[model samples]
Target: MASNFAAPMKVIAAAFEESTGHRVRLAFGSSGKIFAQVSNGAPFDIFLSADQAKPHALLNAGLAEPGSAFTYAIGRLVLWSPVTGRVSDGPGALREGGYRKLALANPRLAPYGAAAVQVLGSLELVETTRSRWVQGENISQAFQFVATGNAELGFVALSQVMKEGRIARGSGWVVPSSMHRPIRQDAVLLEQGAENPAARALLAFLRSPRSAALIESHGYQLPVSEE
Candidate 1:
C-alpha cells in the first residue's frame, strides 16, 4: 500500500476483518520502493500503488494478474504545517519563502513528491526553493518532519492530515488538481495471490460502498463512477 493510504487502510482492513473474518497484513512505502520489492519477489498478496504506472508496470511484467488494476482513490496533495496559520495563504505563503526548511518526499520515490515538484515548477519556484529542501524517503516521513517542527511546512497527502472533509489539526492548502496530473491511485492483485480467497475478497471489499465512504472521509475523491 502507498504510505498515504496508511490511515484509511487501517480502518478499512479492520472493518473487512470484522465482516468477513479474513485477516489482512499490509506493507506501506513509496510506490517506487514497493514496486522494486514486489519485482524482487516479495511475498505480498496485493499491490496498492499511489499511481497507476507501477501497477500497470507490474501487469506488464506478469507480476500482477492482468485486468486486476483499478483506481481505488484519487489522492489530493496539500501544503501543510502543524503550526496554525502557517500555510493559510497557500501558494502565496510558499512564494513569500520566509521559512528556512520546506519538506517533501523524494520525487524519484513517491508520487506525492512528484506532484509537489510539479506545483513548484508551475509556480516558477523550483530553483528558489531548492536550497531549503528537506526531502523525505516517503510522504509519511515528510509529514513527520513538519509535525515534529523539523521543517516549517511540507507537501503531504491530504489524507495524512484530514478527516471528515476537514483538516483535523493545524492548517493546509489543498493544491488544485489543475496544478498537476491527476493522482489516480490504483490497486492490483499480485500473481502470487491469484488463488488467495482472502486477497480476492479484500479487493472486492475495497470497492464496496462502505469502504468508499471511509476513503472519502479521509480526504480523497472517489473515481467518477464511484462518486
Candidate 2:
C-alpha cells in the first residue's frame, strides 16, 4: 500500500481480517520504491500504488495479473502546519514566504510529492521556494516532518490530517484539484498473488461500499467506475 494510505488501510485490513479470518500483513512505502522492490522480486501479493503509472508499468512487465488492476481511490493533497491557523492562508502562504522550510515527499518517488511540485509550479513559486524544500522519502515522513516541527509547513495527504471527514488537528489548506492532475491511485493483483484467494478477496473488498465509506471518511475520494 502507498504510505499515504497507511492509516485507512490499517482500518480496512482489520475489518477484512475480522470478516474473513484471513490475516493480512501490510508493507507501506512510496509507490516508486515498492514498485522497484516488486520488480526486483519482493514477495508481495498486491500492489496498491499511489499512481496509475506504476501499476501500468507492472502490468506491462508481466509482474501483475492482466485485467486485475483498477483505480481504487483519488488522493487529495494539503498544505499543513501544526501551528494553529498557520495554513489558513492557503497557497498564498507560499507566496508570502515567512516560513524557513517546507516539506514534501520526493517528487521522483511519490505521487503526492509530484502533485506538490505541480502545485508549486502552478503557483509560480518553484524557484522562490526551491532552496527551502525538505524532501521526504514518502508522504508519511513528510507529514511527520511538519508534525514534529522539522518543517514549519508541508504538503501532505489529506488522510494524514483528517478523521471522519474533518481535520483532526493542526491547520491545512486543501490544495485545489485544478492546480495539479488528479492523483488516481491504483491497486493491482501481482503475479505472486494469482493463486492467493485471500489477496483476491482483499481486492474485492476494496471495491465494496463498505470500503468506499471508510476511504471517504478519511478524506479520499472513491473512483467513478465506468460500467
Candidate 3:
C-alpha cells in the first residue's frame, strides 16, 4: 500500500476483517520501493500502488495476476503545514520563498513527489528552491517532516490531512488537477497470492460501495464504475 493510504486503509482493513473474518497485514511505503520488494519475493498478497505504472510493471513482469489490476483511487496533492495558516498563500508561497525548508517525497520513488516537482516547475521555483529541498523516502516521512516542524511546509496527499471531506487541522491548498498528471492509484493481486481466497476477497471488497465511501471520505476520488 502507498504510505498516503495508511490511515484510510487501516479503517478499510478493520471493516473487512469484521465483515469477512479475514485479518489483513499491510505494509505501507513508497510505491517504487514496495514494487521492488514485491519483485524480490516479498509476501505481499496485494499491491496497492500510488500510481498505475508500478502495478502495470508488475503485471508485465509476471509478478501479478492478469486482469486483476484496477485503479482504486485518484489522489489529490496539497501544500500543508502543521502550523495554522502557513500554507494559505498556496503556490504563491513557493514563488515568494519565505520558508527555509520545504519537504517532499523522493521524486524517484514516489509519484506525489514527482507531482510536487511538476508543480514547482510550473511555478518556476524549482531552481530558486533547490537548496531548500528536504526529501523524504516516502510521502509518510515527508508528512512527518512538516508535522514535526523539521520543514516549514510540505507537499502531501490530501488523504493525510483530510477527514470527511474537510481538512482535519491546519490549512492547505488542494492543488488543481491541471497542475499535474492524474495520480491514478492502482491495486493488483500478486501472482504469489493467485490462489489466496482472502486476497481475492479483499480486492472485491475494495470495489464495494462501503469501501468506496471510506476512500472518498479520506479525500480521494473514487473510480467511476463502468456499469
Candidate 4:
C-alpha cells in the first residue's frame, strides 16, 4: 500500500501504533512484483495492491484467502514535477514544459501507470512525450524518479505527497477520475501471513474510523465498508 497506499499507510500506521502499540512495517512495490514474491512463499501476512488483479492472482495461485480480499482505497493519478519553475496544473502541463524526461511505472504492472497513460491519451500528450518517457519497474520507483529529480516529472500516486489533508509544496495536477479508471486498490491476507497476528491487526485497523481518516488525509478516498 505504500506506493498507492504509501502515504495513507504511514498516516494510519501512526494511529494504529499509538493506540495499540503494535508496529506495522511497510513494503512498497507494484502489485505484480509483490504478488510474485508472496507466491514464492514469502512471509507477508497482508498485501495491499494498486489493483485487484494481483490479489486475484494470489487467489488463483492458492496463495491468498479468497474470502478475505477487499478493496482498501481509490487511487488518483497526478502529473508531478520536481523542477523549480515548471508548474503543472493539469494533464496538459506535459506539453507546456521544457521537460526532457518524465517517469512512470510500467502500465502493465501498476494501475497508476495505466491511469497515466489514459490521462496522456485524453490530453493527446502521449506522442509528444513518448520519446522522453522513463519507465520505472514499479510505482514506487517511478515516484522516486521524480522525487530525486532523476526524471523532470512523473506520474505518481497522490498518496505520496498528500498527508494530513494538505498537498506538499511541489507542482502537480491531480487528474480527474474521468480521465482514467478508478484505481481500486485491493487487500488480501496471504496464506503465508495467517501465522502473523500483526497482519490481522493491521487489516482490522485499516478498516477502523481512525485509520480511514488518516487515509483520506493522504489524498486517497476512504474505502466503502465491505458488506
Best by lDDT: 1
Give the per-residue lDDT of model 3 (tens digit) for 103-160: 9999988899999999988888889997999999989999999999999889999999
Ranked by TM-score, top first:
1, 2, 3, 4
lDDT of each: 0.93, 0.92, 0.91, 0.78
- What TM-score against the true fold does each predicted structure earn? 0.97, 0.96, 0.95, 0.89
Q: What's the lDDT of the predicted structure labeled candidate 1?
A: 0.93
How high is the lDDT of residue 80 in model 1?
A: 95
Q: Comparing 2 and 4 by TM-score, which wins?
A: 2
User: Count of backbone clashes for each model?
Assistant: 0, 0, 0, 4
| Quality of model 2 by C-alpha lDDT | 0.92
Model 3 clashes, total count: 0
- The alpha-carbon RMSD values of the candidates against the true structure, listed in the order shown, are 1.1, 1.3, 1.4, 2.2
By TM-score, the better pick of 3 and 4 is 3
| Candidates ranked by lDDT | 1, 2, 3, 4
Candidate 3 residues lying further than 4 Å off, grouped into runs, are none
Stretches of candidate 2 exceeding 4 Å from the true structure: none
Q: State the displacement of the C-alpha of residue 192, model 1, in Å, after optimal TM-score superposition.
A: 0.9
Pairs that collide in candidate 3 are none
lDDT per residue as tens, model 1, 1-227: 89999999999999999999999998988888899999999999999999999999999999999999999999999999898888878898889978999999999888889999999999999999999989999999999999999999899999999977899899899999999888899999999999999999999999999999999999898999766
lDDT of 4 by residue, 33-90 (tens): 7777887877788989888888888888888876888887888777777654455456
How far residue 212's Cα lies from its native spot in candidate 2, in Å, is: 0.4
Residue-wise C-alpha lDDT for candidate 2, range 144-169, written one tens digit per residue? 99999999999999999998777889
